[model samples]
Target: MGETYGLLSLLPIAVVVITAIITKKVIEPLILGTVVGAILLYGFSFFPNWVGDLLATMSDPDVVWTMVIPALFGILIAMFGQSNAGTAFRELAIKYVKNKQNSLLATYIFGIIIFMDEYMNALLIGGTMRNLTDKFKVPREVLAYVTNSTGTPVSVLLPFSSWAVFLMGLYGSSELLDGDGFTTYLSTIPFMVYPMITLIIVLLFIFRKVPMTKYVKEAVARAEKGNLFPEGSGPDTEGFEDELEENSGNTKKPRLINFVLPIIVLVAGTIMFDMDLIIGVILAIVTCFILYRLNGTMTYSELFDTSVKGIQDMVELIVLIIAIFLLVRVNENLGTIEYVITSVEPLITPLLLPGITLLVVAFLGFTTGNYWGTMGIVLPIILPLTQMSDVNTSLVLGAMVSGGVFGSHVCFFGDAVTLTSASTQVSNMSQIRVSFPYALAGLILSFFIFLGLGLIV
Candidate 1:
């Protein structure tokens, strides 16, 4: 462990955080940070080392699983979009969404229902419900907030999701824990304070039991005056607008089954396959293809084209995830987590471990904009600390998971934020600014909850 570069090990991630915040970009900063880490470790010969790490990280099985599952979901979502499934579902839900509060309620409900993955939740809910929210004079920021809030928070809280599966895989492989990964994860569910609290806050805001931040309040005022999108406040959504237009042109009467059946297959298949999301996603895609083909909604050629387009759309995000994996590898080689543990080891007693873990992991998650990557880096370090101090492992583990969700929730460049912005047509920065206050509230509340629980348990 002393082979670590000590204090210097912090350089790479610091570079990422500083550059990311300054530029409000994700991939470029990630790449630059990895390069900085490589240079720190290998000097001028860093090129070969960086390339090797990049290749190895890209080929990692877990990394592959993460990338592949989302890409498959992308293809499935494209099919759903092309077949007007989301539109059909939106129409069904719109009946109950006759007012502003009802629209928020409907969006919140659908966001929870599509909890297989954050990506799916954001894409489906934001795309499907934006128009409904718009009709009720709800700001796109509010829609983005509802969509983004429910995205990771819901997925992480639910045991049967890509988030839980990925975390379990990480925990399962760790030598520090004694139980099966799935069961251990289930143990942490009740203590996952940040996400659970976040969901509660989202509900409170939805029902007007809690006042929104000034940004959201202002946006709401703007929205009620016939401006659903604040000027210069969102992404360039012409492409999505075109897609929505094409979806609206579907000649067949929109059947609710076209939307609901594939998702049912996804959820049921996942349960049947021992919670492997890949199988569920593939099953959903196949179900969509067969259903669409038989219904004459899309031809074979059209289905193939849409499938390919979906994969193409995911290419950029996949590359971003790969960049995140590369940074994780660089951190490992630099012994970043080891350095952190070593530097802080003396202060990490049993009583403070959970709170400190949450703060540390949350900072890493926020700065890096990669919850899984941050978890991969920190959990190994955390498990050893939990073991050494005889702390309640489940409590600290819950804090770690909560911190990752908080980071993902608040990070401006996180994939959830980007997806929500795209689907809701809200700007990425604007979404972050609008949601950060709420996210911070969750973080502060969760920190105390972990601390209190640590002392009690």
Candidate 2:
């Protein structure tokens, strides 16, 4: 679409990032950037045409399916709260996870277990564990860091996940790869250094092996003083508290099954049927309705009402996801990534390609706040580059995955970051400010590791 724009193609991405940083609001910037991209692509006369295109894109069955799944999952999350299952789980967690170290460890473990979808992982874990972590004076930011770290990283590492399936599709369709897409993806797992090292960093934080950033330190200190969140550091948790109180009044005791059974159904259904996450979550939601109704904890009407409320809760995030999709379409049309890659192609060497690819993908992810988009744009380009050079294909592929994870992990306006913050009640910028140092550490470590591996392999 941007056969003639060249470097001017990057303006939309620049507008998105700069506007987001200045305004601390994601939706407006994303919409604005998308409109700007449309204007850039088709000129002043195409605004009406662009509107038609956006409507068509958003209404496409595949787009609607992807957008609705996360929102449906949100209903399951809210069901947990409505059933008081989250509170019951928290009480159980408090019984066993007594100290800060164990709480952090448990958080990490749960994050890893919910690896099928990053959105579900962040929302479920962050929501379920925030109160527990606060009991031990662990900042919401720390909870966010732990939860966010395990999300996309774990999803990409685990071959059974949606992320793996998506990557496999990308590879299978590409002309460069020789073997089965699933096989290639499994092979690349071990070499995903950014995600691997990022997990290590989380462990170090849990074990007190790594020094906390200044912001994190202040958060910890404030939390120790019984202030779970620093003043003005995050959003209000009053709505969450009210929701919990409303649910906790149910006469029936909250059972752990309310939490465990649904997650089991979700995960197991996905694995057993080789299905999309939407199907697993749908099965889980049906299971929840039966269990809750049969146990006298919720009536059919109340369950229906609560499920609607849950979907309502996710409306903002759903809109944000749609905006991200639109922005991605805009970038695709603008050829921003093509311009970026071609601009840097001449300077790449076999020894430097891995590191450079990692940096470039990470930069794109950071700027675009869209990991899937970054991977979609960069992988095809980078994979071909690797085949033409003396580069190790697996290592380069690993770097690509790592860079996407790194960007999603650290990008302030990223979907994962925003989801984690909302789930934990932390402000977007607060989470970003606290987690940036750790993400930076992982990025630097990955860059050097890939550079060395590129040279050796």
Candidate 3:
């Protein structure tokens, strides 16, 4: 067996993490980490002849294609941009974002409404408000803050979200009204600490003049003076046709259908067939060509031409996805994630469980930068509570999720963290620095909350 603690096993992981932090790029770190691991396992004294096997595994098409589908799914979205779908969507959003106060309050209100599902709320609110939020220069993190804070707050309180279904699956209903374990799960929704506290914090941040950061402040200052950020970014007519191929924006209204129809296929197909997101996205990209042909946006030859054009639109987003993946992978391989989890387990105790849960989950989120993984582990493990008959599982699970989300909101390395930063054009550090105080306050309040919860339950 391989030595878990030896330098050979750790070198790859170390390089990956250090490089990721310094460069803030994901794919390069991931590729480099894998290469290092292969080197360690195959250095002359090691499995010298096994280099081929290691290489084959790393080159596995599945690894590359996993993201391909989601990327394609993203392309389907690009079609919308090329046409008029995005403009239509923006018009609808503007009606809602009417003003900053409306935008901020709406962010909270929707956060509460999307209670039935966390992921749905995340994408729906985040994507929908991209235009409006950008117009307001509301710092992508604030949108993230609102989306994240509300996503869980509502889910934990509502019995209809994926969590409810998960609990139902975990503890099959006994049929009677109160006999169902899910009901206990549902009742505990109020007990969820971090999300609830986070909701309150967002409300205050919105109503109060809580200065966020220089960039956020800049956005606000501009908005106060009535200005907007760059629009139709990523790529443009000049960027694609003039810069890339010397073509011009000739595709017309048909372009709109080319976008909408493909997205319907992607979202509907992915959700209905439960297809992998990456696969669904890829298919959507292909669909764009087919639809373009059918709708007259391009002929077969032009298909290749505009395909390049359409892809250019998503170039920044694609780069972001790859970078995020590499960084995430490298960090995982390095053992930083492992150390984060085990190091704090021993520190957990009954009296300290609530506060510690926040700290530990925050650290776990920082290390793994995962919202779901933190919940899965902390909720199941943690101190002496797995066997306690008197202890309510709801309170426990809530604390875990709350703490996890708190960390995720600020973890400069996590997916959501990166997504918010990249989409908003703010440096990752700016998002982190701006959001930290809010997350910390939520963590503190949640600690006391679980303390009171401990007695009530």
Candidate 4:
């Protein structure tokens, strides 16, 4: 971060944000940004042969490993989906939950279970439950809410998650804290106000049978009128007949064991083996094939083709993740991240940490507009702060995650929001209109909880 052409260092970050805005796609923007960053690195003499170095580094095993695992997970999901396995799963889940509320709850339950990573949780749950919720008139925003609420906090709390590993490395390097990874991460979980409150909010909505928000309410009404898109998508009169045709003929008779047995296998396999999620996901995909084969859903080659196609659909997401990673990395190099952390660190008292952290996280989340990117930047700062306060690290980490999810929840511009809007076939504004108020409510509640914990700790 030497000052000569320091401004140039920020070009890549800017490139990404601007590209994301203009193209509304991630892969190309990131790759372009990487090239720009390489040029800057060369011009600034940041490294010897920096341009070549950066290009080589782009394909580094660490970088590629990050790409492969998430992409692999996406591939597995795509496979299951394309093979009509997900459609079959949906048909079966419909039989069990019959009630929409229960169906939503089941989503919450699995969202909590897939705590190994946030991105994994977002894509996996969204892919699996998309059709089921669609069948029951649930908005994709609600599903996004469920995924966002559960993903981050659960990972922060769970020792085995990639979040834990990164936090350990970041915090461990800071010289601000001295401790083992387990103690450090565990100490921060309770203070993660957003996810905790989010879970509570979800339960309240389900248990109280809360009516959907106004936009969501309208979304539902439109859905029932046989239109999932906004009324402008050809309106429903002539369109409804065609939509009915799209949904009608392929509805498979529900298979109890086809769904039940595989889920049991998946849950059991992950827990019993204490598996890495890549392995865990691979196991799940394998289970899909086995169940499909057993239940006579598709022949072997068709399963392979569907899985490949499913994985292809998520290429956009994989590119987004990779690009977001580079954007955060550039932020780190540009000193913007450090400037914010240093300027804000002293502002945090035991009492004020919760509110301030949440506020700051929201701002970062909004600017970066990425949950994982937000967490990657913030965790390094807060992990050390927890030691400074001599507080419970888990609670502090919880607050960190809470703040991130809080921002991402309302960020209609984020990848998750985009995907939710896509799957629901709803307008972006519709997702925003519905998610914002809900996000605000959850944010306020989570802030108070963090304040309470900060006071107590």
Q: What is the TM-score of each candidate against the true structure?
A: 0.85, 0.75, 0.52, 0.69
Best by TM-score: 1
351-437: candidate 1 lDDT, tens digit per residue: 888988899888877876867766765676677688878888889899999999988888877787877787888777777878899
How many clashes in candidate 4?
A: 19
User: Cα lDDT for residue 289, model 4?
Assistant: 83
Ranking by lDDT: 1, 2, 4, 3
lDDT of 2 by residue, 1-457 (tens): 4557897788877787677657656678778888888888778776886787688767855457656765676688678767767556566777899799999898888778677668767766887787788778888877888889888888899864557756765565455688766668878888899999988888998898999788888888988988877566554642344433344354556688887888898878866776555678789999999989888778899789988987887786567656766676677678665675677678668898888888988886787676665675566557757876758899989988888898888887778887788777777787888778889988998899987887777
lDDT at 411, model 3: 73
**Superior by lDDT: candidate 1 or candidate 3:** 1
Residue pairs with backbone atoms closer than 3 Å in model 1 (clashes): 234-427
Better of 1 and 2 by lDDT: 1
Clashes per candidate (backbone, < 3 Å):
1, 0, 12, 19
**Count of clashing pairs, candidate 3:** 12
The Cα local distance difference test for each model comes to 0.80, 0.76, 0.52, 0.59
lDDT of 4 at 52: 49
Instruction: Kindly report which residue stretches of model 2 are placed more than 4 angstroms away from their true locations once superposed.
Output: 59-62, 114-152, 155-191, 211-252, 325-342, 360-401, 404-436, 453-457
- Candidate 2 achieves a global lDDT of 0.76
Candidate 1: regions farther than 4 A off: 36-44, 159-162, 165-185, 212-225, 231-253, 333-338, 363-373, 426-434
Number of backbone clashes in candidate 2: 0
